[model samples]
Target chain A: MATTSEIQSNRDLFERVARRRRRQHAEQTVFTWLLRAAVLISILTTVGIVIILVSQSVGFFAEVSPWEFLTGTEWAPLFSPQKFGVLSLVGGTLLVAVIAGLVSLTLGLGSAIFLSEYAPERLRRVLKPILEVLAGIPTVVYGYFALTFVTPILQNIFGHDQVIVFNALSAGLVMGLMIMPMVSTLSEDAMVAVPRSLRDAAYALGATRFEVSTKVVIPAALSGIVASFILGVSRAIGETMIVKIAAGATPNLTLNPLESIQAMTAYIVQVSLGETPQGSLEYKTIFAVGLLLFVMTLAMNIVGRWVISRFRQQYE
Target chain B: MNKQESIINKRQKLHAIRVLRDRIFVVGFALAVVVGILGLAALLFDVLIDGLPFLNINFLSSYASRKAENSGILAPLAGTIWIVGMTALLTIPIGVGTAIYLEEFASKNRFNRLIELNIANLAGVPSVIYGLLGLAVFVQFLFNGSRSVTAGALTMTLLILPIVVIASQEAMKAVPSSYRDAAYAMGANRWQVVKAVVLPQALPGMMSGIILALSRAIGESAPILIISSLVWVTFIPTSPDSKFTVLPLQIFTWVSQPQHSFRGIAAAAIIVLLIVLLSMNGIAIWIRSKYQSRPDQ
Candidate 1:
């Protein structure tokens, strides 16, 4: 016992303790720097993007005041004497998006209810993959489908003279088809988050599947459903190629889906396509509109994310 | 006895109506699924019909046509590869690093919560806004009015970074806590464990996510639209500074032309683009299936 005690005391018991501390300090320092860089990068990206957009768009603001950009009825930002109307684009975008939103709201919510409340195990497995596949298809492919296939169908319905070669109806209809999966997917998540206890209680109260889904499930998942709607709107607002190709760039302020109208996204595409003298006000307007689009989508996302988070907290 | 019999009859009618309504709902759901399937099928069929008729070696090898007689998507294809490759390079390091920081090091605090929310918001921002950002910041400010492959690639990197970060974080979170505990018990430093164990295991998910992100980058039109001008660059880009054309931009230009035959070329180009997209998606699906441990299990 004496020998063991002496050996333990003599073996330089705390040797290299200072060295270990120094090593740890170095690592901590490195990690701190790395983390700071990451946080800085993200914030910098956001600030830099906003700053660059504002800087370029200043010219656009100088040439055409914010009120005019927001409220102009005619959208000929180019051509002789230039009519600078933002509403023309906004009107087209809203018409298409609203129609698409309605179509998806009906189709998507219905499917979500059925899948969550009514689907058997087998049907769910098959249907879920199909929905994923639907979301996976690229937007460009959707654009082509709109141009070649959906446009013809719209033409048939409206007859030859009524339908433009490319118009808003085809674009809106195709966009609805594209976004239905997103709505259904989000709404299903919301529906699934409803406590099973609630469902069981509803069943105890003699509620039928339709009644439970409509009243209980939907009410519980209302936040998610709202979120889905906003998300669908976000997709509609940002979509470009499909509308550009299917909905022609004639920025006439009209509610008729038969006629072609340019959207905000399409305006960016239209302006970018030609030689619009870089750094010119006309050129800068693209970024200004883009900033507006960004703000709109960002607001929509915040609302949507809030709804989703609240609904999620209510369940597992 | 008469009251009992009437009540029974009423209950039976209610059950019958409920059954009928359920059946109607089932039918409606089935109809919706069928319509969705047919819509996608119709689109694929069109791509096959128009493009498959001309999906040959000659189509892949040739340059685009000014007269619609001898146009190929060679330059665009090359540009697509270059931009996509460069974007992957840009996104992977930054994205994966960010995910690591958030998952392993970030303290659960308000600042972290803000960062998380900001990332989510960034993910949902429109792809075209990225194009505008690229135009103002990269094309003009950084490159000084240069519309090169680098501008497009840099733009796309920002565009896809949000997706990559989200996906990477999700995969990192999938790592079991027990593994970290085990490594700690074995006296491994945090960096050593993360580097030697966590990263290797999470790599497949990150790689698959990168592939999928690149697929989106390649197919993206809006940002590429503002970054790369629609010039007829017949030669492949040999450097970052060289002007280029991507598949989507090329397809857009051809589709919009006055000539009808150019439409066929656009369709062909689209088919090629679809193949790339589907292949990337396929790899992602495969990786997901491989890594999926039942959440409950």
Candidate 2:
């Protein structure tokens, strides 16, 4: 029934549509592949970080026995006798982390409870941003604050002889303040996520506001709170400038927060700030220390992720 | 009757105690907020008061000197600018592109989940570890032990990449799926839909996120310190290979000095650094609020 000329025009239109669709399909595939490459770069960065740390660290281990490096109590690699025990640094790091943990947990949790439970929406909106300003400050500035202002204040309280100029207390305290926002924000999110029914149920039982918040809301958000604490500890461990400037570079094996100590990060900065030649044992010590720090933070991060995901699954 | 009276009296006492406890808890929480805000206020006040005396044009323009009076932030400030500029150039495309890939293109499968996990982990890695990576990979291996500005910038790029990627991904995810659906209905393919519809909506978010991340990079000094230990840089860096120092690093050097005068100068440097960061953060916040308040298309 179709005329020949009409059939030819119809065929031409079909071909054009097919061509455009094919062109589009081709373009989509190419663009998708390009995007895949972009994703691959992130994986490559991880691999690169591992390779660089391990390869250099292997060279370091060959120079110094791994057992000696890990178990040694002394860490004065640059000084005479060249001791390379990493525990002293680890001890100092943990001391600071413990102080930071206590400070941030108590203060941060207190603020989070208030913000999530007590404060009205309008007040919360105004206050939370102001609190987050603490997180935005540079660690270096905090370091300066810790060294000049906080140390003097601590000395005034503890006596000048008790609180040395570069003791770990000031650094730990400031580091806690630095990480408080992270704790408060994440914990507040978890607290806010707790079902209102739980609170109502507590109220029905004649529970006070404080009792309900502490007993019901906090327990419901326990996993998230734990995750925030772990993440905060991990951050405290990795913090460099605060410890470097305020916590002195003396690698003393002491638990006293008032005593000057060198954190693992501070040790790396100490070595790097001076001229340690490449391939030397002292230069390679940084990579080794970095490896230890990487493992510690990585473990905490993994656990934190697991805890958060598990918590989400429960609520979801 | 006597037992019941005793029970009622005990309940009343317990209730009264709980009420008092609740009041105390409220006061304690309020005090926590005060401590946080007071800390911030004290820090700002201290920096302003200490640094105000030394914050002059000469301090901004001159180079570092052995003497506190002659030392300036010119070299370090220039270095910071160059490093951040190059860092932005390297990060924005890769970070945004990766975000697009993960959000729009990648199938929700095991492999994609791994990449997601990898990015999250990378975000948690310390800035100083990135410095060690730079020291090993970029400075020593690539540049033959030269602590060049290129090395520092590349180090910073890696340091901030995870942040930028995460922020961009958040932005891309926030773009409504309806826009994509509308584009697809118009015979646009996946790439076309994403390019034409999703990006415009996400651009404002992506820009703001990148700005915030860059502001963080500006304040970061640890990685730069590990990479470029040359503290007394007298001239501004001209090229990628030139030796450099950044604002925080310069401040660190000055702060380490025991001299009282050096602290003043360090405070001046701190002011400059704060100004740069605060302005960037303000702009980013402004952009976010502006776009967020606009009516949907």
Q: Model 1 has how many clashing residue pairs? A: 2
State residue A285's C-alpha deviation in candidate 2, in Å.
Answer: 0.8
Q: Write down the C-alpha DockQ for each prediction.
A: 0.55, 0.77
Please provide, for model 1 over A1-316, each residue's C-alpha lDDT reduced to its tens digit, 9 standing for 90 to 100. Answer: 5697788766655556657767976886687577567656666678777887788788788878888888889877787678788888888888888877877777788778777888898988888777667677767777878888888888898798999987888888888888888999999988888899999999899887777887798988898899999999888999998888889988878989999888899989889888899877788878888888888888888888877776564555
B1-297 per-residue lDDT for model 1 (tens digits): 999999999999999999798778777866676677777788888878877766788878888868765788899999999999898888888888788888887888999878887788778888888888888788888999999999999899888888898888878787788888898898777776677778887887787888888888988888898788665768899999999999988888877787777777778888888888888898888888887765652
Give the interface RMSD of each candidate.
1.9, 1.0
Query: Which ten contiguous residues of candidate 1 chain B have the minimum total lDDT?
Result: B288-297
Whole-model Cα lDDT per candidate? 0.83, 0.91
Looking at candidate 2 chain B, the ten consecutive residues that score lowest on lDDT are B288-297
> What is the two-chain DockQ of model 1?
0.55
